[model samples]
Target: MSTQQPAGGRFQTFSAFYPYYVHEHSNRTCRRIHVVGTALVIVIFITALVTRNGWWLLGMPLVGYGFAWVGHFFFEKNRPATFKYPLWSLMGDWRLFFETVSGRRRF
Candidate 1:
């Protein structure tokens, strides 16, 4: 899916980027992997805080991005939006995660 840009040729707001983000995750497996990756990231974060394990903190990106990359490369068959829109992409991931878990969106 193409990113619909405004006159500036960029998404000026997250609301704009979100639709493109959703389009990018059209593959069911990709969305599922993203949800799982985000969940694991949250769990890892809590573990790191509870156990004072800085090493676990370091594993967050590895686990999260690894699963996401697998989904993207093998399933989604497209480059991740993260490479271009890092902050918004992360926000999209968490939003999609909560939406899926809360029944607002499908798994």
Candidate 2:
């Protein structure tokens, strides 16, 4: 896969970036917050579509990143990987969300 690295890092693959992603979220609360934020983002997306309230779409990034940044700042005590690896970090979030929920990885 290819990416547009706005933060100018060397991660070439999602497979390669995932380990770092996992490490950044080592805190339990951070991971839990991420799960909740991801779920809420999904709900927000569906709500936007169902309700046809474009305003709800505005909350997607706010709710998603707000919770994520809170986890990073308070629990992880680190910067979010999203700042550097936007696409991969997003991929990581969904992958993590699914993995945690589907029993492939522990919550």
Candidate 3:
């Protein structure tokens, strides 16, 4: 698959980008790390809401991206789609996480 984006230079829709997103995360370890990061992000977000400690909210990206980046660098050996497609990449992350958890996709 082409890791460089489509012929037109950018992804016109999320639906088009999603398949590429899944392809990028082909590594089992990478997917598992991403899932763990997402789960931690959820826990951190809830803790921030419940305790009213807004500082904890700052950890969302750190925890999420930190783990994901490590997985990409060490396991996938590729750059993160997040750098080029932030919003869609985030959506892709959650979608993949849910799919894996639901047994629709492999972890």
User: Candidate 3, residues 28-51: lDDT per residue as tens digits?
Assistant: 999999999999999999999999
What is every candidate's alpha-carbon RMSD to the true fold?
Answer: 2.1, 4.2, 1.8
> Which candidate number has the best lDDT?
3
Clashing pairs in 1: none
lDDT of each: 0.91, 0.89, 0.93
> How do the predictions measure up, each by TM-score?
0.91, 0.89, 0.92
Q: Model 1, range 32-84, lDDT digits (tens) per residue?
A: 99999999999999999999989999999999999999999999999998998
- Greater TM-score among 1 and 3 belongs to 3
> What is the Å distance of residue 69 in model 3 from its true position?
0.3
lDDT of 2 by residue, 27-93 (tens): 9999999999999999999999999999999999999999999999999999999998898899999
The deviation in Å at residue 75 for candidate 3 is 0.5
TM-score of 2: 0.89
Between candidates 1 and 2, the one scoring higher on TM-score is: 1
Q: Rank the candidates by TM-score, best first.
A: 3, 1, 2
How much is the lDDT of residue 86 in candidate 3? 98
